[model samples]
Target: MKKPFIFIISVLGVILESCYYDNEVYLYGNGSGAVCDTATVTYSATIAPIMASNCNSCHTASSGNGVITSDYNNLKTIVNNGKLLKSVNWTAGAIQMPLGGQKLPTCTLAKINKWVDNGALNN
Candidate 1:
C-alpha cells in the first residue's frame, strides 16, 4: 500500500525532473532583432539574442568562469578571441553554444562582425 505509492511517486518525480530540463534555444541568431545601443558598445539587438539563447547557459557571471554574455563587454572578448564571427565562438576553443542548437547562420555571423567592425557601439 504505502510502498506502492512511494514507488509511484519516485518514478513520477524522475519523469517530471527530466521534462523540466530545457536546452532548446527558442530563438536563434536572427539578425532581425531590434537594436539597443549602450553608448560605449553598440549592443546589437541581434547579437544579445544569440548569446542569451546560446552562451548564457554556462557563461553567466554567476557560473564557473563568470563569463557573462549579457552585454557587449563580454561579447567583444568573443571578437578578440578570433571566434566571434567564426563558426565555433569561444575563448579557449570551440564551444558550440546552445549545447546543441543549430549552427549560427552566415547572415547572423556577418552582422555580428559588421557591428564589431563598426566600433561595436551600443547604438
Candidate 2:
C-alpha cells in the first residue's frame, strides 16, 4: 500500500511539472530574452503586416463592417479616429478586435502604440 501510494504521488508530481506554461515574453523575445522592441517600429514593415495578419481578414473593403483596413489610407482613418488603438487595446467603450480571438500580444500593442504616438505616419 505504501509503495503504490508513493508511485502515484511521484507520477502526479511529474505530470504537474511537465504541465508548466511557457512565458509569452520569453517565448516571443525581441532579440534579447523577454524584451519587446517598441523603437524602430515602422508602419509598412511593422504595423501593416500586423494589420494584414490580424485585421484585414474581416475589415477588408467589401466585407468590412464599414471599416476598411486592407490599405494604408483606410487604416489611417481608424487610427486617426482613435478606434484602432482603443479596439486593439481592448479598452472600454471600444469593441474588442479580432473578435472572439485572444487579444493581441503586449509587444504588438506596444509597437502599434509607439507608431500611433509618432503621428501614425505613412512611413
TM-score (all chains, Cα) for each model: 0.48, 0.72
- Alpha carbon lDDT at 105, candidate 1: 57
Give the CA lDDT, 0 to 100, for residue 36 in model 1. 27
Q: lDDT tens string, model 2, 40-100?
A: 7898999999999998999998889999878989988999898998999999988999888
Global lDDT scores for all candidate models? 0.59, 0.85
For model 2, where is the 10-residue window of minimal lDDT? Answer: 23-32
Off by over 4 Å in 1: 1-44, 64-66, 87-93
Q: Which stretches of candidate 2 lie over 4 Å from their true place?
A: 1-33
After best superposition, candidate 2 residue 49: deviation in angstroms?
0.5
For model 1, the run of ten residues with the poorest summed lDDT: 21-30
Q: What is the lDDT of residue 110 in candidate 1?
A: 50
lDDT of each residue in 54-98, candidate 1, tens digit only: 677777777826455677778677667665555344235566654
TM-score of 1: 0.48
With candidate 2 superimposed using the best TM-score fit, by how many Å does residue 87's alpha carbon deviate from the native? 0.4
- Count of clashes in candidate 1: 8
